[model samples]
Each structure stands twice: as structure tokens, then as C-alpha cells.
Target: MSCSIKPVYGAQHPPLQVMPKGKEERSKTSNKRDAFQDFENNTSDAWDDGDDDLLVMANIQMSLRDVRSTAQAVMENHSKQLSAQNQQTSSVKDELRKLSWSGIPKPVRATAWKILSGYLPASLDRREPTLQRKRHEYFGFIEQYYDTRHQEIHQDTFRQQHLGLGTILKDIPRMTSLAHLFQQKVVQEIFERILYIWAIRHPASGYVQGINDLVTPFFVVFLSEFIDNDVESENFDLCQLPQETLNIIEADSFWCTSRLLDGIQDNYTFAQPGIQMKVNALKELIKRIDVPLYKHLEEHCVEFLQFSFRWMNNILMREIPLRCTIRLWDTYQAEQNGFADFHLYVCAAFLVRFTQDVLREQDFQGILMFLQNLPTHHWQNEEIGELLAEAYKLKFMFADAPNHLSKKK
Candidate 1:
């Protein structure tokens, strides 16, 4: 899939400006032109910040027939078997496994994730105390590990957030729309401290760019655990949140993310062997599934790593909207081998999606461009569901099917 869109470094997506009408449009036209000129020169503002993700909320079409029916199945089991709540864990676990394929409701998502990720204690009664103890340890570790690297963490975190506060505000509309509290320095420190410490502890795989993105989903989800209302609709003030709650959110996010990275530690370790293997695996898998697209890409001299690195690195976060990513993760979290194994199938599905268009691409540059900026601009809930189905089918058909995960790409 070659494109004639020209070579633009780091242009993750197309320009997001929605044209206005009449007099206001005319007045802003000149200003808009200047802005776009600056965009061309720098390309910093081209990063997809997720403001566009909000519109897809209305589009989620997860099958509710089974999912809705089993919505509170876990809660029901917990209440009914209160005396030996942990005893009925077998049935509850079975129910969670069945129900998670569709998606977990927001209210129960945090607890479900904890159970699935192996972060929760087997004794149900000990979860709260464990959470408190772990959170205390996390904050304590911050003083021990990050006390010396505070300035480095601050700079690294901000650079991760599109360079700086002023830059994040000026460039990424998504953060500004969320609230001003996100840009505060203390808020940044929480994330930086957690990531910095984790990298220090896990010397095998230090901090990676996409690891920062991985933290946000968990942070927001766990933070939702403390709040009762719908976090997406409400305008919750971060400043008003208690320091204790922030501590819990930060710590939980860290541990859950650590538990997550444990499975795919190779992805960030020593030259990122995990991604290299995945890219090779993806090319092999694609060749089996969509031979035409694979041949087309090969014809154009587009290497698998050219575009698949983003696919593997971001775990489809850069490709799909956040709403879809959370839903997708619900299923991914449910399976013990979901993120490390199932994610490859998701990458395959996402790759073959633009088969016809990609095949039509006549040059290597065009193919690389098309692969980078996948046509997911108008995707919604239904599209995500369909994509997952395709990924599932791929997994079903190809299990360790890519041939022992070839090391020599």
C-alpha cells in the first residue's frame, strides 16, 4: 500500500481542523492557513490527542443480550455465597471468563481487572487491606527511588506529554478539553514517579514511550473505582480529590501496569526483541491470512517494521480511539495470555483492514503512509466489535501458528 501523501515525519494522522461556515470561517481562514503552515514546518501538533475519541462513545455496539443479562453475575455470586465468598470462586471465575468476551461494565471493571491480572489476593476479604498496604509501599518507594531523580522524572514526563505544559495546551486539545487539572505539576509527578520507579526496578526493560500511554488507561479506570458516577460524562476536579485517593490510584496503576508488563517484558527489553518477533510474526501471519496484501506490501518494498512497530508498540491505542481500547482490553485482560498472544491477532486484523486500498497503492512511500495513517477516522463502537471478531477468528485459526515465532526476521 503505497501513498502519494508525501513523506511527513511523525504525522500520526491527518489535520483535524473542522471547517466552519461563512463570516467566521472567512475571518479564521488566514489564521488557519498560518497554523497549518506551522504544522507543516514542525509536525508536533499532528499527534492524535484523543479528543476525536469521544464521538465514538455512542457507537459501541457490544452485544447486550448475553452481556446485559450477565451484567451483575459476579456480584450476585459474591452476595449469595457471602459466608464462604472465596469458595464459590470457581463458578464466579467461570462466569467472568464467559462474560468478559463481550465486555465488562464500567462499575465492575476495576475489580474484574484486578482479579484477572493476578494482582488481587485470593482471599476476597483481604483486597482492601492489601490495596492499602501496596499503595503505602508505592508512595514509600517514590521517596526511596525518585527522590534523587525528581527533576529527571519531571522533564521526562513532560517531554512524554508533547514537550511541556504550554505545548500540551497549545497543541493537544484532548488534554485541555479533559480539564486544566491534568496539566498541573504535581499531577505530572505522580505519573512520572510511578513510571520512573518501575523502569529503575525493572532494569531489563526500562521506560518506553508507549508505556506511558499504557498507564493512562489503568490510571483512569482505577481512578474510576473511587468515584461512583460516570467518569466520562462528569467533570471531576483532580485538585479536589483527596491525596490518599490519588496515592491509591497512582500505586494501583503502577502495580497493575507492572503485572501487565511482566507478561510482555520482552517488548521493552534489550533492543525490543518482543516487537521484532511480533513484527516478523505479524508478517508471517498476514501472509497466511491475506496473501494479496502481503504480496502488495512486499512489492512496494515496505518492511513489516515500517508501520507495524506503531501497531505493536501502542497496542492499537494509536490506531483505535480510547473508548474502543478499553472495551478491547476488557477481553484482553480476561484471558491469561491475552495481551501477549491475542494482541498479535489484533495487529493482524488491523493490518489487513485496508487491503483493497493498500493493494491499490502504487509506491513504497504511499504504502508506508497508508499503513501509518490507517483509515480509522470514522470508526465507532460497531467497527471495533467487528475488528475484535476478526482478531478472534485469526487467533482461532492460527495458534502458535506463525511457526515458533521466528527469531531471524
Candidate 2:
């Protein structure tokens, strides 16, 4: 079988999975080869005439148009959300919350994330000044921690020993830079500065290996908010942006990331109590839900921590595509106490999504490898919606109430 490559799509519309032209050509070639080998004398009907190839391409384009049409609901929701009556209305908030669970429209995702993260000030009067103050403060960090050239040496390995960090991560200093346009060197500098400053201020929970991964979602979301063009269709020329605008994006991302980490800080502190607890919770939940699969894992002596450390650390950002991660985060931010609790359920759903393939692998190495590289590049909005729906259903079935994770508690 040949590789199924996903098409390069625009961000103005929702992701619609399409095959790349190169892959299509390869498939056509493969079909011709099969036709020749299978029945050389009477293979005209069996041979690919390219008619099927045309239909496949046509179907993919139509699917894209459908996704675009579906996103119009978010546009309408944004307009409704602007109504003064909808500002504090429970009905309005409830509707917004419900819509976000499935997906937030790209037209209003930035505003929705701010509202969900509690980063946006509720009082209309305080919004601008609050933003200005935060933006200025962010630059203050740049001036201070980032004064020297970008360096990767440990600040004090003894301090890390004193903190007694239980887990050792390779290349802990550099974090995930989600956007591809930024130069690798530039991205490294940006994260090093921000993370170093954050670590110094927090003291209790300084820069950790996975913390870098946490920053990407916030950065990409906020960058989308600031940049006029879709990042998918065009490259982000960081130098072109006004210094002030760039600073604001950086500040917004930093604060939002800090806010998220605030709730889950226990996970990163010494020994990672949150992760240990989560691993146990996940094992228990899986045992209750899928006994045979749990048994299979147990038989292989495959510890959940071996596979799940990165999952908890990165919030599954590494597992799925960036576009889908945005959609997943929308529901997560919408849920009450989402990051700390609801995320556990999302993980469960994600694991079960590939249960059949996972179960097929009996050995520890096979199962481990299969999970680390889940086939997600070709997944589109439909797949994401279904995943969230399943995740929500799992949350509903297991959680104590409408907005809680029962097993985690």
C-alpha cells in the first residue's frame, strides 16, 4: 500500500481532508501495476481509466465546501455574542458553552479562547488597559531575562537536584514552537526567554521539559488572532509585524499559558504527583471500561506511565495535528475545570479511538510504537467532531455530574 498524503489547505475554512496530487499519481501507477499482474489478457475493466481518480478528487473538494458551510454557525454565534443583552445572560453563556464543546468557529476562536481562559476582562472598561498593562509587563520580562544571548546550559543543576525533579527529559530547555514559519533559531530564542522569565517568577514551578509544549497552543491561537492572514496559506513574517503587536501576542500567550499551568502546576512540580495520579486514574478507568484491553496491557507488563508521560505533559498536542488541537482545546476550555479534570476523559477517549489497532498488538513494544504514531495527518473536521463527541460521551458516562471527572476525584 502507498502513503495517503493530506492536502495543504487554507485556514480560512475548516480542515477538509484531501489527497495530494503526488499520492494520487502514485495510486494510479499502483492500480496499473495490479491490473497488469492480476489478469494480463483481459484487464481493461480491472485497469484504472482515471475516472475513479477524478471522482475521488471531486469528493474531497466537495467535503471541503461542506466544512466551510458548517463553520458559518460560528460567524452567526459571534454576532449574537456581541449583543449587549447576551453579555451577561445565562442563556447566551450557555449557548456559547454548548457551541464550543463541538467546535468554535474560526471567525471567533480567539475571543472564545480568551473568554474561556478567563484572560479577557469582563468589565468593558478594564479590557483595553488590562491588555496594555500586561503587554508592557511582558516586555519588561524580555528586557530582563533575555538581555544575554540565548544559552542552553543549566542555570544551576544543583537547584534542579534540590527541587528533586523525579523525571528526566532530554533537552528540557527548548519548547514546542507550533508555527512552521518561524526560524528554528528564532523559535528557540522566543521560548527560552519567555520560559526562563516564567520560571524565575513562579519559583515553585520553574521551566520543565514539557512546559515548552504547553506554550504552543496559546501562541498559535493568539498569533491567529493578531495575524490577518491564515498561517496555513501563508508564512508568518515575524519581522514584518509591529513590535507592539508582536509584544502583545507574546504577552497574551504567556499569561494564558501561565493561567493554564496554574491549575495543573502540581503535575510539573517534584515527582509529578498529578501525572502519577492521572496514570492511576486512567488505568482504573480503562479497567472499568475495557477489561480485556487492560488485561492485555497488564500481560505485557506495559506500564501506562511509559506511554502516557508525554500525553499528560504535552496535553496531547504532539499526538494530533495543530488544527485539530485548536478544536479540541475549544471544548476543553469551555468545560468547567477542564484542564485539570476534563482532560483525563479526553485522553481516555483518544486511547479508545484506536482500541482495535492497539489490541491487535500483543507485545509491549508493538503497542507502544503504534500509540506514539497514531495516523492523524489525514483527519479532518469530521474526525475531530466524532472524537470530541466520543470524548464527551465518555465524560458523561464516567463523570460525577455535567462538569466533573468522576474517576479523577
RMSD of each: 33.1, 29.2
Candidate 2's TM-score reads 0.69
Candidate 1: segments with Cα more than 4 A from true spot? 1-91, 150-182, 227-235, 400-409
The alpha-carbon deviation from the true structure for residue 255 of candidate 2, after best TM-score superposition, in angstroms, is 0.5
For all candidates, the clash counts are 5, 0
lDDT (Cα, tens digit) per residue for candidate 1, span 1-409: 8776555456665444445677546756565445454455566465456543533433456687867667778777777788576557656666777788778888888888877777776467888888888888887888876775547765665454333334322322232223454566556667777677787777566666677667767777887887657555225566667987888788888899889899888998778899998888898888777878988888878899989897787787777766677788888887658889999988888878889989888999888887787777677768878888998898878774556344346
Worst 10 residues of 2 by lDDT: 163-172
Residue 66 lDDT in candidate 1: 62
Question: Looking at candidate 2, what is the lDDT of residue 92?
Answer: 46
Best by lDDT: 1
Total colliding residue pairs, candidate 2 = 0
lDDT of 2: 0.71
Tens-digit lDDT track of model 2 for 1-409: 8998675433332334347999767756775445334332343443466545643453354577777876887777778877754566546456678778878887788777776777776456767888888778887877765563234333453265342222222243333333354444444456555666677666666667778777777777777776675455126666766766667777888888888888999988888899988877887778777778788889988888988877888888778877777788888888887888888887887888888898899788999998888888887778878877777777778786532424545
